[model samples]
Target: MREQTGLGKVARRQGAATLNPIMLARDGDSRLALYAAARDHLRARGYEQVSMRMFRAPHAPEQNGPSYCCQNDGRIAARRWPALRAALPAHIYLWLNAYDRRGPGYYSAEDLAWLDAIDPWFALNRRPVPSRGKACLAGELSLSVDGDGELARCHFIPERLGNLYTDDLADMLQERSCPRFKCDCYIGYAQRKDLPFQRVFGTGVLARIAPEQ
Candidate 1:
């Protein structure tokens, strides 16, 4: 399911006083205003850091359902890159998933090239971007736990490594190598060993935001 658009309502319901809420923005200029409004709402509520992740195709279709696939239609055109970049507020850090050997939502070679070209823009504007090329921290530094306590390597990969309620957490975490060969999700790849997450966000790389300069 897509993230709810009611930023204020979500904050209130979750008691997000100290929470850094991450809003999802679908790829396109049409939704920029909606996300910008959400960003403003969060900032007004004393949230110094609000992140926005660009929606990628659900890697777990069995869980997300077939109808949720809209990667191609939702993809932002290369020609619209400048407009999209300009429209986003500086405070809202945007994340893009690297193109990988995946389906439906997989970014094309051209898209990767576009990402290379736009890397400087993100850097110049002080926005957070992933390190170039493939990298993964899944099943290594982080783990995803479902509502039922099923533990997985990452959110994108649904293969259950173990159950939190039944299995030893330490044993479950023992396997450093991921069951999958590749990871295309930003949440998975952003924590690459080579990435400067520790230097930027400290130990709380998953939740912490880089402080403004």
Candidate 2:
């Protein structure tokens, strides 16, 4: 999707935040402004489908919390989740399937490899995201852009691709390989305000470094 040019040599020389080359993804409840800006910026560069946008599972219990995407659509929108799935043209699934989320475990590289191969958004028009009722397929496609000028695969979430974490948007875009989805790292760290830092440390890594007891 890079036939044109938006951030040219001038931009690169200027040291602009250049594209992260990552596909930022988020449910309706997350911050999509970054994603939108990324999409617009990438599009300007003559790139089509450089990134993608998607909502979460319509039937997922909202008790967990509402995502930015959810707020965009009304509760009624979710209520019609089934109709939404039916209306969709056979190929447009977002998130992983129930089987994927099944089992007590952490995400593995195999998981990301499997995901990168997904192509759920072939046709771009939909009132609501299709429901899980439909058969699952590999949703490998441009999802959305990152705040940086990079083209992304999705709008709300960053791809771990084998690495447990990926904040580098540039590498994500430049590299098209899917097998490199195994590692463990996430950029910058911060958790919900409600959750205590101790919870994250859990007296493991921190205890070793903190002042002696």
Candidate 3:
């Protein structure tokens, strides 16, 4: 499963008018375009075990709706295109699973291929993303929030900072750290190392803030 920073939650909390029906519609169109791009990329690589399903939101009710169970076979992009299309938002949360029966390394290869397909889309639309001095293991460059409204380090490792109602986010980000050696997961590292600040964050914010360790 892949999710961005809790921007959706923040948007809802802030009551950002940007999530209106008109914005959602535009975002839906972008999702469909990316879906077509991903499907084509997989087919070209001769991968057939991959499947994609879109949910309205993370942990959304199963019965509520899904875009469709799109596979390599000719089942089209989505089921009930009109209804499902409208449900997608600018930030999509994807639950990717590979059932490649061919051999090992199947899942990862397919995942990388999918990332290859969507990376360009993210790059082209990328904007100036604010980041703390250090990067978290999660794909996005932002903090997660705990149930108590406190800032969290990461979903996998949930150490809470003081509540947002009282504490400073900048201070919280400064205080957080991983227990083990630094997390070097693929997506995390890609954002921190492989891509340039221009490609990822629109400007040199990361490079400027983070001098060589």
Candidate 4:
């Protein structure tokens, strides 16, 4: 599968990977926070900063697809592993995550497959990072659970429930899957329009929870 626009031809290099120095950005989080978390994660692991281009995290409709955080070549936020790692210069791996499933947005197997064609290991933001939900989350249908626990299932007919955390993106992944598909996290949240939240737990506050289109 080929990418349509915005970012195209996403691929990866050959080498042993390190899931240490990571960046996860989700709703309610800021780009600054994302960078700090990534930097700290790497620093603790003995990695240093080289060239970090922390942009005003992408917003809804601004992104191209389910895995928009990846670069045209599907590298972490398009950091171009070699270049971004130049300053600190270490054979390390970085992650650019987003909100999770059961939050808002319909990330299905087919959608995930398309993302993989962009990047083999392009993971889904399965870990449900706490964030504000888009009042009008657009997708096949809204299938999610809020902090208070609310569910919206059914592509055509919708169903709402209280304390609905049963359908997590991680658990959803288990129901159906593709062998080659790779997204480390299980869930992610969509971006908020008004004000963003502050986080420091490797997500929300920092670039731990990567936001997608």
Question: What TM-score quantifies how close candidate 4 is to the native fold?
Answer: 0.19
Among residues 3 or more apart in sequence or in different chains, the pairs in candidate 3 whose N, CA or C atoms overlap within 3 Å are none
> Candidate 1 residues 1-213, lDDT tens each?
232123332333244442234431222223447666877776676554412533333232343432223342344355777567568665433454332334663555676566655543233222234333435566766788754476777765656688889998778664354444444444664556665654666655565455565
| Regions of candidate 1 where Cα sits further than 4 Å from its true position | 1-69, 74-84, 87-92, 96-117, 120-136, 156-159, 196-209
Please list the residue runs of candidate 4 whose C-alpha ends up more than 4 Å from where it truly belongs after superposition.
1-80, 85-93, 96-120, 123-144, 147-149, 152-158, 164-213
The order of the candidates by lDDT, greatest first, is 1, 3, 4, 2
Measured over all alpha carbons after superposition, the RMSD of each candidate to the real structure, in angstroms, is 15.7, 21.1, 17.1, 20.6
* Residue 149, model 4: Cα distance from true site in angstroms: 4.2
Instruction: Return the TM-score for each candidate structure.
Output: 0.41, 0.18, 0.31, 0.19
For candidate 3, the lDDT comes to: 0.41
Off by over 4 Å in 2: 1-79, 89-179, 182-213
lDDT of each residue in 115-211, candidate 3, tens digit only: 4343333322222233345444332345556434756555434344557778776665543323534432323322443336334343334332322
lDDT values, one for every candidate: 0.51, 0.32, 0.41, 0.33
Q: Give the TM-score (vs. native) of candidate 3.
A: 0.31
lDDT of 2 by residue, 54-75 (tens): 4334344554554434224323
Measured on C-alpha atoms, candidate 1 has an lDDT of 0.51
| Residues 1-213, model 4: lDDT tens digits | 122111111110111132112221222324346657787776676543433532332232454454333332232344353345455323222443333324445456865665544432245343432332323121222354333354433211123332355544433221211121222322223222221322212243234333332
Which pairs in model 1 have colliding backbones?
none
